[model samples]
Target: MAWYHTYFKGLPQRAWKLNQDEEYTDYEVDFLRDVLEITPDSKVLDVLAGYGRHAVPLATDGTALTCIDISQEYCEELQTTAGRGQLPIEVVCADVLNYALPAGQFDAAYCFGNSFSFFPRTEMQQFISQIASALKPGAHAAIHTENLAESILPNFQARNWMPVQDDIIYLAENEYRAEGGYIEAEQTFISGSEKVTHHVRQHIYTLGELTYMFEQAGLLVVGTFSNLEADPFQLGDEQLYLVARKQ
Candidate 1:
């Protein structure tokens, strides 16, 4: 199994619960609805859907949703929930980088929760291209992730810990290699007597770099925000929420 599979496998139960907080999910759904201009007749794609935090709500709003994730457990859970709710959601378990998507099939698509930087630069470009290919011409694509600018900031922390839930804490140690434009992180989740660790390397891209990649993928940038709330992006922002349209 892939390293990420093991990493994410240990996270689903607690991570899903924390991420599926009602307020956060509602904000995300509203953000996507506005940015993607979603409607009841829209066909949407949620890559790296996890436990369907965004998918369920989007489907419940009457949009047709296709959710793809690497975790079979997450996919199964999402499938069961969609079935129980009789929502228009289709769940698929597959690696987003290589997953096959029907060309021009979607009206909008998104990858949230910092899932954009999972691969190296070349592979990341391919991932963007694949997303563009999956959407109809003029369809919007929204991507949310940590801003690379944060890594270059002087106040960047090499190690940090934060409470994720009642008894769970998340600890992260980061190493940024400027020359390679990548950040390697070791993350630990501590819950009572149990602890789990995972290592991940993410290619960090400047706004200009990301814009070039999106252009190469036939996705033209339309807007860039600091977050899902439509705040203007400025220097020192920690998160980037970019919107583009397939050409």
Candidate 2:
């Protein structure tokens, strides 16, 4: 089984949650709304929307959100949260590559939280194609990742540690495999007396490579930004946000 199959269950989930804050999420939501031209009547898809961080807010604003995530723990939490707030969110717990997306059903779609780097080339192409198929013609899609070649290669670190919370620390020991075009990492989350560790891998794709993949998927690469501020993507940027439109 893949590491991600069980990665998000225990301490990783807690660490991930701690890594994000309401202010940052709000900023990202605003950027998504503007970039996707979202409206109350729009139907949106949140690919791998763990815990409904973006879905809940967008749905609360009246955009219907269909969220798909593989983690049952996350799906249940999202379902309960949506139920409590009466948000228009549909949580689907399944691997995204296996899901049969409704053709032309969504006005916009997004894979945020650096989750876009999860798949290798072939599977990633299929993933993008599925999102394209689910989008109406001219509909847009956004993908965010920290594993973009230009963003990561220039600042690659062998090992790093960051505080997730006052008591929790997240450590990563990474190895880059140029032949495989992937980074394998041993990720550990330490909190108080408990420590949880997992091995994970993320594929690295350059801008040109990703653009070509988008083209092959019947989507046109429109813009690439380094941040939510809509700044053009450049080398040394910490993250990448790419927007494409269905052809």
Candidate 3:
């Protein structure tokens, strides 16, 4: 499997089916809209648009939408969601880095819900460039992600579990290592048939580091907010939403 696919390939997608309507709060939506300045007729590219959480609602504004994800399941699900609402949208199943996105086609693009920080610095820059290449000149993009300095809930550490049908779902402890740039977790799923354990890993990017990556990709920063509410960013905002335009 490609590195990008490794992120969610082992996830219990079966459980995810239960969270279809697990909607984001209005606070989140307004923040995205303000950051992206989303507008009607904007040709939008939703990268790693898992489960259409953010894309579906944006499409309601009558924007042309294209959703891409590393998981085929998600791509299919996004398309199905669009179809159910008679929304015109395109779904692509491919790694964001390797996908041959049409140059200068999108009016804007977005990578929400911490998707931008999944890759290391080297890989992250490529992700930004991929977005730049896919967008028309001056096209805007918004990225929503955890702020390494703000999101480490160190005070909260412990294991939690709940029974789900035949499975005992457990969320293991979280570790923020490598100067808060690397995160890891242990997940155990116990079912009557078998026990499955997943060790997940992700790279976290600081705001300074992310800004450098965006600049390297020739994207100019126009806005930065702490969350989806257009709140001014602070030292520990938990979330960072950045808006930039392709140069």
Candidate 4:
């Protein structure tokens, strides 16, 4: 099993929830609405949708949503949340690679939360192609990632630690494996009397390479932003939010 399968269960999940606030989610949802030109009648697909942070808010306004995630915990939570509100959200607990996406069924799609870096070259290509196939012509798709070669190479850190809460400290030891085009990280979360650790890997790609991949997948790269505010993506930007249109 991949490290991410078990990485988000304990301390990391808590930290993720802590970092992404409701305000931030609203801002991102607004960006998605603008970029994808979403309407209340639109059908959207959320790949690797963790706990429905974006899906819930988008669905609340009447947009139909189909969210796929590997974590059963997250899927169940999202299902319960949607059920309670009677929202139009279909939660699928399955890996993206194995799941079959219906062709031309969606008006838009997005993979948020930096989950684009989860796959290496081949798998990444397959996923991108699948997303392209899933969207109608002229429909849009967004991908967010902080693992771009230009983004991380300039601000590479060997070790870093941050306090998630009053008691929990999250530390990361990262090694950039140039040969593999990925970063191997040993992350640990230390809370009072307990410590949880995970070994994770994130694949990195250059912007030009990603553009070519999108082209090959029958998608056109329309724009790249540094943030949800629609700022142009610079070389050393810490984050990347890309918008593509299916051809």
Candidate 5:
């Protein structure tokens, strides 16, 4: 199994449950609506839509959504939620890189939750290209992730810990491979009496490098934000929210 499969498998349902909170869900939906300029009739594609965090709410509000994820468990859970709520969501369990999306099918698309850099450089390029191919001309794509600038910060820490929920604490240790231009992360999740660890490797890219890749894929960079609320991007911002339009 892939490292991500092992990692996501170990996470309990409660870990996914936290993202379903109304406050966070509302903010995510609003971000998509305002930033991506989505409407109730828009057809949206959500890449790596774990547990339907954004899918369910958007579908509930009458937007059409197609979600793809590698985890069958997450897909099943999302399907159940959508069924119960009678939301218009189609969940597909497949690796995003290998999945075949209908050409020019989506009006808008997004990949959230720091999911962008999981693949190596070449594969990441292809992944972006695939998204671009799936979008209608002039359609928008939003990517939310931790900025590479944070990894290169002078004050960067190799290890950190934070509580994601009342009972769940996440511990992360990182190593930067300057030669390879990637960062390797080992994450441990502790909840109650259970503990699980997952390893992730991500390619690090400067804003210019990312822009080049997106442009090569025919996705034109239009805006960059620090977060979902559209805060102006800065040099040292921890998170990057990039918006692009298909050419």
Candidate 6:
């Protein structure tokens, strides 16, 4: 299947070169910084670190990073970028569901931009375990996902602008099918050359289920919120940000 290639192998160029928001964004950049609570001595692991978007910046800011991705293309891009710089970023190209945990204690770990939902529940459990294995006791873990309730009803829809080119843009309308964590939609991109449609699907989990999964994985759900600001979660919130620590 092209799932790995489409999502990981091809991500770096599309993200950095094409300006995809998941890889390059000030808001998220700031958010992960806050999530890591980065320190000069922090050793961080970013699962599904694509295009080195988070790793490069985090490494620049002085946090030693080990970035794991499913795509060799992204790993190569990250390595090349690191070679062009002074910092050493550990980049691994392996399936997140199957990547072996690095053998070292880490200060913090994270999976941002809703990277976990790419797998079904069976894989999600193992993904959580792999993340926990990377951490020392009491190390913090943060996961950011789109609001869960919104996915339950699939009543949410929005049109947003994405920069497809220097002067061109793509108008994207996103929707979800609320039935049992199934979310599917389309993104139609309009530019001078062609009109392209991108199909998307993700399973959304509610707060209860999210916490339940974390606890099942032997991680304590210390807090849950709707925004990176750590605001209390409320229905209709735009996002679901969860924070935890290994038990």
Q: Pick by TM-score: which candidate is best?
A: 2
Off by over 4 Å in 2: none
Query: Candidates 3 and 4: which is better by lDDT?
Result: 4
- Candidate 5 regions exceeding 4 Å error are 16-21, 150-152
User: Once model 4 is optimally superposed onto the true structure by TM-score, how far is the C-alpha of residue 32 displaced, in angstroms?
Assistant: 0.5
lDDT of 2 by residue, 1-247 (tens): 7677899888889889878989999999999999999999999999999999999989998899999999999999999999999999999999998889999999999999989788889998999999999999999999999889998899899999999878889999999999999999999999989999999998999999999999999999999999988999988899999999998
Lowest lDDT sum, 10 consecutive residues, model 1, at: 147-156
58: Cα error in model 2, Å: 0.6
lDDT (tens digit, per residue) of candidate 1 on 20-59: 4688778988999999999999999998888888889889
How do all models score by TM-score? 0.93, 0.98, 0.83, 0.98, 0.92, 0.81
lDDT for each residue of candidate 3 in 1-247, tens digit (9 for 90 to 100): 4334654543355544443334563456555666666677788899988777777877887877898888877788888889999886888888877788899999888887666656777878888998998899888998877635555553335466666644545456667776747767676665566666667666866677777888899998887787555677777677777889889
Local error of candidate 2 at residue 239 (angstroms): 0.8
* Candidate 5 residue pairs in clash (backbone atoms < 3 Å): none
lDDT (Cα, tens digit) per residue for candidate 5, span 137-194? 9999999877465535555679998777688887889998888888788988888889
How far is 195's C-alpha from truth in model 6 (Å)? 4.7
As a whole number from 0 to 100, the lDDT of residue 247 in candidate 2 is 89
Candidate 3 lDDT (Cα, whole model)? 0.73
Q: Per-prediction RMSD in angstroms? A: 1.8, 0.8, 3.2, 1.0, 2.0, 3.5
TM-score of candidate 6 to 2 decimals: 0.81
* lDDT leader: 2
Q: Least lDDT summed over 10 consecutive residues: which range in candidate 2?
A: 1-10
Candidate 3: deviation at residue 116, Å? Answer: 2.3
lDDT agreement of model 1 with the native: 0.84
Global lDDT scores for all candidate models: 0.84, 0.93, 0.73, 0.92, 0.83, 0.71
